[model samples]
Target: MDLNLRHAILSNISDNDQSQLEATIVDAIQSGEEKMLPGLGVLFELIWQQSNEQEKQEMIEALEQGVKSATAGS
Candidate 1:
């Protein structure tokens, strides 16, 4: 997603009553629902915005490792 939309979503997360939204995300993940991934993309975007370059690099490395692990398992 584009940075502007990411910022907008993060702004909404900051400004809105987020408890329900957060619950929904948690529920989706716990249910092992692939549909919830788009919601997770919002989370990833927010994390990206809040992180510095070094932190982002670390996060990406972690994500890459996770992906490799998952793919290997599959």
Candidate 2:
């Protein structure tokens, strides 16, 4: 992420909201719980805000391909 955008998001969001997001991500990583990955919605929103539709489609396709490979390996 760009420093300018990071600054913008931090400037616009409340400190408590930022803390909650951090905590959620940390909990998800520590617990290995799929449900805790709701923090990824923030990532989706950031992509939506920053990218064009074609870019978003490419991103989604890449993620789908990554999942397929990951599960195949498992």
Candidate 3:
């Protein structure tokens, strides 16, 4: 059984307005619930799929720096 979680998530939110999408993302992130992680991952996947090389590089650098900062803090 190949369950398509990302497809389901995207279908669920595809009709949302910009403000709704913003709220969904903000609430999901702020709640820090494990359940929200998959939704966030789907959002990130969509963003990655849409981004060009420069944007992707910037994202990668930010993620690297963020991990470094977090590890340092820990």
lDDT of all predictions:
0.77, 0.67, 0.90
Please give, for residues 1-74, the per-residue lDDT of candidate 1 as tens digits: 66786676667567555786777667778999886676679987667999999999999999999899989957
Give, for candidate 1, the lowest lDDT window spanning 10 residues: 8-17
TM-score of each: 0.62, 0.45, 0.87
Better TM-score candidate (1, 3): 3
**1-74 per-residue lDDT for model 2 (tens digits):** 45675555555444557678677557667998775454445545765889998998998899999899989957
lDDT comparing candidate 1 with the true structure: 0.77
Model 1 scores a TM of 0.62
Q: Summarize candidate 3's per-residue lDDT along 1-74 as a digit string, tens digits.
A: 12598778989999999999999999998999999999998888888999999999999999999999989957
By TM-score rank, best first, the candidates go: 3, 1, 2
Number of clashes in model 2?
Answer: 0
Backbone collisions counted per model: 0, 0, 0
Relative to the true structure, candidate 2 has a C-alpha RMSD (angstroms) of 8.9
